[model samples]
Target chain A: MTALAPLATLSRRRFQLTTRTPRELLVPLVTPMLFALVIAPALKEALHTGTAYEAFVAVGTVGLLVPLNTMFSGLSVIVDRENGAQRELLAAPVPRSFLVLGNLSVALAVTAFQVVALILFALARGIDFHTGAAGLGWFVGAGVLFAIGMYGMAETLANRVPKQEEYIARVPAIAIVPWFLAGALFPITALPGFLTWVARFLPLTHGLALMRYGLLGDASGLEHIWSMGSNTAMAALSLGVVAVFAAALTAVSIRVFARTALR
Target chain B: MIEVRQLRKVYPGDVEAVKGIDFEVAPGEIFGLLGPNGAGKSTTIGMLTTTIRPSGGSARVGGFDVAENPLAARRVSSVVFQEPVVDRSLSGRTNLELHARLWRVEPGVARQRIAELSDALGVADLLDRAVGDYSGGERRRLEIARALVSEPRVLFLDEPTVGLDPRIRHELLEVIGRLRAGTDLTILLTTHYLDEAERLCDRIAVMHEGRIVALDHPQRLRHELGRELVELHVRDDLPAALAVLRAHGIPAEDAFSVGSTLTVPLRDLSAGEAIATINDLGVATAISAREPTLDDVYLRLTGDRLAPAA
Candidate 1:
């Protein structure tokens, strides 16, 4: 229990620093809302989707924003490292595993609320729920796991990049643009054959597929976990992917952090 | 107690910052890591405090390994980093609380410790104001206060008084001295100010080019050099004066020409004898013998003085 205390403290500190100024929350919350209300609707035709473009994009945009927040929020780790706060935390008598897990948990919590809000708004705007309560549970669960994966990816980026601007420029494209190429707005079947092939390798494609089918009941059932397979199997598989990705990225992130610290 | 054995850190592209330095500090002793700019004092502190990993060698704090069990090592250590790491937007109390959380002290205990440390550091009156409103010296004091909240077994202070006015530097040193006496704190500090090292550190290590060149109690370090430093303002070629002293079999290795003054080392001689030797050279107008200081010891080891921009 004492060994776990540092991890608890680490989580508390990271969350405190993330919320140090009320202004820090604005970018993560406002950017997604902006794309959802303004930019997303305008691109409805350009996206070439016949679904209720407004609600479809709101859900999709919110999903994309999770990854964006992951990258942007994770930049705080870089700031802490440079400013020596990371050193303060690392030096505490806490488990290293706790530090990593606690940080990802905070990242997941921060973005999950906004993602759910956007989903609720879409539902309020007459987007039908396909899988009822069961599907909604899966949807929320997928959002949480996706947030975990993106948080790990973002932390890794923060460890590697020298300047905040470089990360700012790179991670959005790496983490969010994949959502577009994965058919978050328009189905990937409509894309050029080359891009469809590319989408197969993307994690968000599977995630959005799971999410859209759960929400609209319109996606091909093969991809979404709740529909094509038994609910338990789909849940297990989605969580397994999330666990694998988060674990791998976290390992890489720790190494990068340790290297930079030593250097 | 603190022990650092052959600790070295080499940066990328083979820039060796700390090169296998060794030292041990006893409990309740203030040990100063004295060096000029780029002399690896900060790098060495970083490694010892667990902020930066050592590329080679090892260190321990309170019998715990810094590398193998850094958290346990750090549990007994705290650092007031050279740069101000306080969040400018947060109140001083809030800043200290955040650090308190990292160390996992109960909130009630943390508050009591914060109150004690803040009062000791003289920042208790300013606890509610944001740190941004505080002056540089105040910020430094607050950082010291933060480091003290944990009541660490070993305290690492990196250049704690740099860029400070003499009065505030003195006050801070006094505060540190009080802390050292009032608590069983083993302190390791790095500083370029010789006076600070002489006054605060029980023992000092003169670091040069990432290596420990000399280490001993401050008084012993001075006596070991066996020299009285004499600064002479003479109207003669400085190098010739140095040469004349060397020719007379006086080892003046810790000597340098600074402006119109030639600061030279007179080995194994009384002040009168040193003056007579300079008189024999027939170029001395005025000369003075100050008691040997850490500056002289630094000069002896590094072959250079802490001059402007060295």
Candidate 2:
């Protein structure tokens, strides 16, 4: 019971921070829809890939939304620290890792909700799930993996940066730039050699590839999977890559927070 | 119980904050750390609470060494920071519940403790309101209630009444007085208010420039000075007034003229006798005798007033 105390504290704090402000819930909900509406039509027209292009854009939009929402969740730590709540919690008996986990859980829950909503909106607009239930399940799994990686990375960055304005400025650049480079809206193959090499290392690039292949049967050849012909094998490989990234980043976040936040 | 010995904090850039200060608080004692701003009082609290590490020496709170067993120390103690540390977006009840959860209090016990502490702190009516809506004093009381939610054996309050109006400060002090009477909780309080320290502390440690210049019961400290302050308003010849007062057996070293007033420290002289002596000197337009207080003790020890310097 004592070991789980931190998790319970994190759970309650997540609810309080996420729900206390209407803007916290509303911004994550509305921002992705606006991006989808504005960017999907233009991308579809430019690529001339018909409805499939819209599906690609929807996957890309979810990729963007997951990290952005997770970053906002990570920023709550900075908010707590600035407002003195972090000091109170730090002085408590709970382990410092709980603060990172608590903030990440809130981010994951919020990202999951937004991803499902975006996918439903896409389905309403006639984007078919080529592999049906199996594909949709994999797509949501990929979204969760992306959210975990983003939450970890964002939590690490938020701990290192002391000022809120600096965090606010850096988050969009870190979140959106990788999102664009990950071939969410377009194929990374179109980029120059340097950027293409950089894109391959991004966790979102792998996540977007898995999501695209799961839902549409191909990732526009942006991602390389060992079993190219089998969608199941490809999804499994992508999940494996995302899992590694998630584990490594989460470890780093916890380690950095233990050193910095508790200090 | 709390024990600190030769505790030191030297921040980066070679700035020394707390310089080898030692003090102890027995169980259920209210110990006040009184000092002006930048006097290292906050730094001392920070070290004892495990928020800031000591650069040297040791501190133990509730039998746990602060540096070596910080978690154990934290488990036995709680701190109400100088700043508002509650989540303003949440209700005071939610904030207290969050603290209870963090401390791993059982649910039934937590609920009862929260209710009792809120009522005791006079924040029961404000518990359900968002802390953002609370007045400064209300927020401070709620912070204290939150700290109490853990039922810690020792509580550290860092300038608990800072930025509060006089009425609120007085009311909060009364609440603190009641809290001490009703519980065996050991409290280590830091403040700049000399009167508050005089009224509430069992013993007060006066800190200045990263060192404790004096530590004793308020009255004992004042009595140790062995003099009542006598201030005289002279119409003319301030030096002559000082010479005459000294000739009457007041210590010459204790006589000093400030502006138009001649201030002297009188030992073993009644206020009436001091007034008569001043009147006999024929140099006084107005005169007043003041009992020695913590303020005078602080001034004598630190050469600076307890209040913010103008």
Candidate 3:
């Protein structure tokens, strides 16, 4: 099932383009860091409780910003389609899945770097994490799942939209609605009735809830056993949802790609 | 090596881009789908090359169904799109190498093929340079090189030289000819350039408004028209001479007229007979006999103007 050589070739192609200009990386990396360092601090007082304010913002920032890199990088897929390389790739003899997955791997790898940088910054800035190595592993794994999930949304929106500008305009609303409503910045406990009900379905709400539990030892809102497990449950559930989203998005993307190859 | 039957493609807006078009391309032959812009040449090529699905039709490329057996068809064919497909941020060799990988070429063989294709396409010197800085012609050549890396049984080029300079167009045409001479490749080219169809196509299929109007060899299409074109230059009464030709069963066309020059299609008369008949009419000035070209045949079948320009 592995077309290793083509995967390597696509990876190399992605790397070359990324490195050639390097300006493409500036937005994804810098935007997240800026959000983590400057925006989070400015908003911390308004959003945080008496204690664990820094840790709360750190965990939330990691979960929110980690997903965005993959989302941003997946925009390259649409650009490639516009330029006709996507057509060329689809028309090639390689297995259809590799084209998407191979490119998706590049997005994942790139965003992985950004996730690590964010984590290290949080640690250096005096954020705490309990459960030691176990918690830390869950944190990193959650970041990966977050990236994959957002990439799923990116693929779906990018394929469906008529223009990149339209996708750009809509992505923020999509990302922010889930992240903010999930209580990443504020507590979902204090939300209005309709908003609180809606927050239950947001994958980020569950994921961030778990992250906060892992890092700060504050298992607030652990109503069920899945919730009691906190970090493990969040990582498992989000990864599960992400796997399904990735698969469904990929299946739909393949259909869209085939329909559009000659257009 | 390619057969299309009753091929139809209708877009979402109820535009039928291909309406039951049928044609066959012989092995190792250069077949051209020629038409004006928006005549469904690209759509037909798209269908044949497995880039797009047919609404209700079947096309067998290299003896495999493009609809049901797309992978097999793709394995044996390569398409060079009308638009550029190279990754501009990557070097030329890297671009070709990516294509090579998609075709699943082994690493050692991919390396050798890339080298050979670059040398063949005359981009050996620029293999390591980014394609963004390359001129249009250079980029075009690089695309051709990328297409050749797979050495597929059939090659599809959709409007390969629509906006290129004459020199670059000629150069690209030469490269295509060389590919035929050097490899066992069945080339299918779609173009709006009548001259290009005349020069490169072993057989030409003329399409208009999503249907195959005529399909034949360039010379045969001309011969099939069974007419010689006559251009008459008159010092005065240009309209009168045109009227005379119309009255004589030969109508004057705009393609015939320039600086008191008027062209009349001598459809029913032989070239010598037409010239003698015109001389007897005393329309003034000289008459020049022209062999029927694809343009003449095109004008005859679809009228002088091209399908109202989409």
Full-model lDDT for every candidate: 0.76, 0.82, 0.74
Worst 10 residues of 2 chain B by lDDT: B301-310
Q: Supply the TM-score for candidate 3.
A: 0.88
RMSD of 3: 4.1
lDDT of 3 by residue, A113-132 (tens): 76677878877766666657
Docking category of candidate 2? medium
From the highest TM-score down, the ranking of the candidates is 1, 2, 3
Best by DockQ: 2
Worst 10 residues of 1 chain B by lDDT: B301-310
Query: Highest TM-score: which candidate?
Result: 1
lDDT of 2 by residue, B1-310 (tens): 8999999999889899989999999999999999889999998988888888789999999999998888899999999999999889888999999888888889899999998988888899988888999999999999999888898999999999999999999999998887777689999999999998998899999999999999999999988756687878888776666667777865535444546765566767777887887788777899998877787677666662211211
What is candidate 1's local distance difference test score? 0.76
TM-score of each: 0.90, 0.89, 0.88
Q: Chain A alone, TM-score for each of the models?
A: 0.84, 0.90, 0.83
Worst window of 10 by summed lDDT in candidate 3 chain B: B301-310
Cα RMSDs of all predictions?
A: 3.6, 4.0, 4.1
lDDT of 2: 0.82
Tens digit of per-residue lDDT, candidate 3, span B1-310 = 9999999999989999999999999899999988878889888887877677789978999999988888789989999889888788778888888888778777798899888888888899999998888888899889888888888899999998867899998998888778888566999999878888898899999999999999988998887645677766775766666667657755344234446665556666677877787788888588898866777777656554312221
Highest-lDDT candidate: 2
Off by over 4 Å in 2: A132-141, A219-241, A255-263, B232-264, B268-287, B304-310
Q: Alpha carbon lDDT of residue A136, candidate 1? A: 74
Q: What lDDT score goes with residue B65 in model 2? A: 97
